[model samples]
Target: MGLVIPFDDKASDPGLEALVALVAADMNRVNQTILARTGSDVAMIPEVATHLISSGGKRLRPMLTLATAALCGYQGEGHVKLAAAVEFMHTATLLHDDVVDQSEMRRGKLAARLLWGNEASVLVGDFLLGQAFRMMVEVGSLACLDVLSVAATVIAEGEVMQLSAAKDTETTEDAYLAVIRGKTAELFAAAAEVGPIVANRPKAEVAACRAYGMNLGVAFQLIDDALDYGGQAAKLGKNVGDDFREGKITLPVVLSFRRGNETERAFWKRVLEKGDIAEGDLETALATMKKHRALEDTVERARHYGSMARDALELFPDSAPRRALLEAVDFCIGRAH
Candidate 1:
């Protein structure tokens, strides 16, 4: 459903064309290398990996890594390895995510779990995780190893936390944000920071870039959650209400609970705690959100993070990549699907 972003009125928005163009260039090159690496494996292990990798995705993480490298004036071959490494980590999590969520769809296609069975997907996901570490080692940087390893640990920790909090009304914005950082933003931070790490760039520049990526990553996920219900089913590539169907509580739902009245909340409790929602339960939940304006408020929060992300990049000198990175901040919020 997410693939069909609203672009017909592109002219209504200013400054988006250039950023999308630059980001697309980086993604195209990354995609080629990714296809080759995932395809070159001589066995089914590589073949399944290739199938999943070749399945369409936005490739946002790798693009962020490579773009930050270019912005930092990195002129090394190591950036490709770094980009691929970021992708491997992302794909690994995705493979596991589908199994955990018991999801059957991703990127508008049957999920790996559906195609190959959960066991195969789990083992292959492990392969990708191992492959990611291997790629990190190939870069030959202990610091990169430290950064990615720490991010991986935090990601697992966050996933556990989210699992514990999945349908509980007790989950807070603080807990939600923590889970989000671990699940989504930490890698963004690492991806952008790895550029400076590989380039041997200044420490302060590296730190700032990391901050930019982290904030943007958080904002990106926050907006992604909002889009789950608000986005067109075609744009989302899944059922419009999958998150609620899975009993996954997102920021919007979290905030809606906070904002809801007793009667409204009982509806949530029925759907969430009791898991007895009727067919139109999602529409009811969405109405509550609209009534509370939770979606608008969430979008505002995402924009605030995007602003911070762009400001973090101010420490670096201007370049096309830098400009593109800055524009991505706006795209994260302005997009509709």
Candidate 2:
């Protein structure tokens, strides 16, 4: 029998409203910092950067930094700068990712690469990384700087790893996990860890925040992978079959390919490996995933990580921030429905 995770009808909002309310003031500062930093004498730099930055994204990673700092009772302005830095790092990655993937859409708008050529997109992404590091240096916390800098390196490595594994039907689950850890979870971990570090929290609390963010990031990516196959385009901010069309080897593809029969495996090899996708290939892929319960099991795996994220916060006391953090996990996992 397949694993079954309960879906809550009320999880529609993913508890983000509470988190937004909790971090409202600090987030405003972060936003201001972002807008100020994006400006440049080279007009194209701001033009390209603003196009994507202004696009509709939840700003969840930076929000994680702010929320974690609040949870740790931080009263300094360092968290605001760090939050803005985290957002810059994330935006840089998206700009680079769209160029690498040749993706046409991001956050429900034309990808920056599409609007401003790939060269401009890549250059602007570099500019953002430069700004992100500047903010980190200004904070003057070597420990926080180390965490975010290491995350930036790891995120780049993860992207390279994914590039190597792209469209390889034989890619293992371990390989995929390693990729996500570097590309996605590392930033989340760093974003969450820097908060407690700046707040001068206990070592255990710092470790707990790191663990929570890492697990939450993994869960968030897993749900995104699942959503690529089963979610709506409007809700996903991209075409429903974008991953399929791109020949990206996400978890659902890995699971379904492994569980498929000889004929089905050949079908995957043809579309994913050989890039011979034809009409109805996406439908067939989705059907194959459903037949093997690949999407459902992928979500079950996400629930496992979500549980770990919640448990990571057990060391913290009961508070609004803690509650909001816990609810954020539910929101990540519940987006599948």
Candidate 3:
């Protein structure tokens, strides 16, 4: 079930909006940087890249970079370039993921791979990745570059780990966490940590920033996993059973599989491992998750990590940016509703 976050009867909380408001000016600069760097003489590069970039993603990771850097009293323009680099990296992953998954849709429209073909999609993704690294170098901070470069490698490893784990019913919660930590949290931690590093903050504060982003990223991905089963397709910008069809062993699937009986396990193996999904299979899967409270448990886990993210920010003094970042943790968990 979607977590019903009580927010004065509002459909959604104002936390992300508040965070966006706090970083509006900096975010504009980041957007400008992104647009400027994405251009290429080859028409297809800009076409594919701009199609995905113009999609209505919230750009949360880059905003985190800007907010964290400002929170650390950074006065340099490096944060803008770093924020743009973070966005490019995220976009690159999306392009690569769609191609690997053979997904038909992205952000409620035809995937670039579908429109432009897989080879173009992969090559454009590589172009974005190269541009992301070039921007990282322009920042001129070896520490920042180190963090993001390691994140890039970790993200690739995570994609591979997920590929291997797909359709494998034996995947554990710990293994799933490791996959998401690499696939999602590494960039978040690097994005946040780089802020403090660029600002020349102390080690402890930088560590705290990294901790905040890591926990927040975990919470973000956990909520996403929950929403795949509970969320509306329109809000999700894809079909509800996309994950099930792909046979990806997300947390809910893992929990349901582990708790299921022999008959249920057979059902999972038929549908997931063998990709023999038929009519009513998704409904059956939902019923199984509900029976075992898998979806609810997954959302609860997200709340736990969100709490950790908030707690990590305790090292920072009270300020508008800090409040927004704390609210972002709430927003990340709350969005599942």
Candidate 4:
């Protein structure tokens, strides 16, 4: 379906292999169909779209869309259209985010802003967003349209909150959770929630799938935050210091700040507030994390929600797809990038 991205290296986890295969096959099919529909008049739009869409993302959002559809008893292919819409919305946000952050790079390549300038990036992002809304209308489900519209709003709100909250070291854990829910988890929730909505399933089932996506998204972001310093910069593709340099407060930083003593607190205040974070500050931050067992605590929280996600999937039939969906919880929690 696409290049294999092993979520975990442990040889014993065959379930992860199965999950990755299914998710990748389903996601690639959606991507191909969606890009082709962009048409010739928007040639430059598709060109820049190709740069971001073909840049080798794992397509977790689309997978969630498909999995939720299957879990909710959808036997048709409409899930593919919805999944593609979910991905388009996600990619549009990424384009806008890079511009807003003035980021020169993403996934180790020149960002759309860096390669094509802000006007192109912003316009292309708008095109993708409009395309997604058009796809939702084509689905001919008012419920699906409603879910996506709300999700789009939530994603935008999260981005705004993140921009405002990043500079404050006093950023509380609750605030961090809210920002991620808006930026990352809201789409995950919407992607999954739309599945049942499209299928016209009972409300409780839709609620369960939505819960699964929400918890899974939070867990996924938590691990991603942990990997900022705990993971290899080469493996993550983006620079390791990006979060610190951008002053983005994430789970690891929240936990570290919670446990910081006198000097560590001062370090956070100066670096984040003054925007003068130094090379040595990174080591100091890492040490603070180690001393307070912040990483371990955050990992535990991720797993707890991962467990909730698996539990939510129990409403599904005991099929191969269901098993694959269940395994995704663990994969999302442990992924390095």
Candidate 5:
């Protein structure tokens, strides 16, 4: 067996806990596959990978793979390997993202790049990508490969778009959403869709899972952006003002900048566009966002997407997995509050 993350018995969300319990055995095998596949003879490869992998994360993406497969009545063992592949893909993205953002902390610890250097982090990320593909190939599902490979391409495109858009105050809300759809939602959609695809579910159900994951992923990223400014540091796993400091153009900043007065606009341009941030600028930015209800509005938009996610599952009959998936949308939105 692989390294198992101990589940907290005292889950506050009943639905989330139930979903975890429902897939407990499958997740165990998925964990084993993750640990097995991530190993490498290269000393630094496993070191950097383990540093990030062992760090605490909810492992929700892989869980989505497993849960969606079970939801479609899959009895095959292929889901275990596919679930691990999904996790590797997610972890690879995180490693690459930390490097791109020059982020210091990840999952409440020093980033892999910080400990292992950017060169090592990037190479290790490549290694993980290789492993993810290998696992996908081993599962031998053309549908799975198509979904995941396309997602890999979309995620790269999104990263490039985000790099180009960074510190560019003129980036529009629509453009921002586009970037996140590629960067975040594409993988989520692929993960869920692959589950049903491998399970041999109907085209309609597969499409529904894709829609659910796509909307849910958008909602998840929106909440993450909101939490960057409004959430507690302990709960958020990163500093509250990391986005502001990085000059990342997120939805809240777009709304605030578009609605602000001349002085406020100058403030945003100075800090975000020109990277001339002052000591108290984060406080000023927060105050401006609050005045414009930018954070609140962002969460409201997440709720809209969350609603879409919930509605996508209406095609599936009510079950523990269905209810849990519905509540998962609420869980995504609840992070900002």
Candidate 6:
């Protein structure tokens, strides 16, 4: 039998709820900005954009922008615009990612690329990215603009890096970490850092927010890597073993491949490197991963980063925002259970 990690009821969890409630008002404004900016005379732009935007993603990146801004004592509407921009950037990336991965589902629904075609999905992603930059320009903070723009560049680079390394069982942990840092964590770091930048908080506070976001983003991706093998489809919003099917070299795969014996390594090369997956291949992958404790160790790595994320916030005094942020870390790691 495959390893079965017990699932928790996410709806009853107060950790994310507290973060949501804390950012509710600003998030409303951010939502309005998103709606307003998504409109265009070209009908397909709205069609494709709204398909993914309306999908039930938690909008965690934008929430980070709002939460960290508030935590830094920001008292203005700029963060709302910045937050919306962050969401647009994230949504744009998802559209592009779906096309790149040839993914069928996203956020529990058909991927925009699948429904609208890859061309439309890619174009709409570009439209959203253009809108994101427009919103960033409107915010009139050169520093914030620079942070997000650089993140956009870094994300594209990361995607290319991952693509080059895809299906290669020889992928190292350091290379994997570099890919995730560029593809995922850079935006998180920018999102959090902008909050302090807009709030005119001290440089130290800005660095703290950036550190917290960077570490949290790493933990978030690691948990997701583990979940692709262990988590249920309903909670994951995608099929279990999607990464394996796609031949993606996530952390769990990296660890398992590195730890496997000669025959086990040959199995990995056939399945992942050659994409010769057959019936029961996923089960074998999971059983091999379990034998090596790959999933367990991947979650352990996530917890290490989660600890760093929480410690990053130690520079701040205790407050509702701080506590909420801490709980957010737990919420992320708890998904593995």
TM-score for each predicted model, relative to the true structure: 0.92, 0.97, 0.96, 0.91, 0.95, 0.97
Query: What's the candidate order when arranged by decreasing lDDT?
Result: 2, 6, 3, 5, 1, 4
**Shift in Å, residue 155, candidate 6:** 0.6
Q: Write the per-residue lDDT of candidate 5 for residues 166-224, one digit (tens) a residue.
A: 99888899999999999999988988898899999999999999999999999999988
lDDT of 2 by residue, 232-303 (tens): 888888888899999999999999999999999999999989999998888898889989989889988999
lDDT of 1 by residue, 214-250 (tens): 9999999888888886887655656777888889989
Q: Candidate 4: global Cα-lDDT? A: 0.80
Of models 1 and 4, which has the larger lDDT?
Answer: 1
Q: Considering TM-score, which of the candidate structures 2 and 5 is the better prediction for this target?
A: 2
lDDT of 6 at 266: 98
Best by lDDT: 2
Global lDDT of each candidate:
0.81, 0.92, 0.90, 0.80, 0.87, 0.90
Q: How would you encode candidate 3's per-residue C-alpha lDDT over 282-320 as one tens digit per residue?
A: 889988998888988898888899899999999988999
lDDT of 4 by residue, 46-107 (tens): 88888988887778788878877766778777788888889889899989999888877777
Weakest 10 consecutive residues of candidate 5 by summed lDDT: 1-10
Shift of residue 177 alpha carbon in model 3, Å: 0.6
Question: Could you tell me the lDDT of residue 211 within candidate 4?
Answer: 90
The true-structure Cα RMSD of candidate 4 reads 4.0
> Which scores better on lDDT, 2 or 3?
2
Q: Give RMSD to native, each candidate.
A: 3.0, 2.9, 2.3, 4.0, 5.4, 2.2
- Per-candidate clashes come to 7, 0, 0, 0, 0, 0
Cα lDDT of candidate 5 equals: 0.87
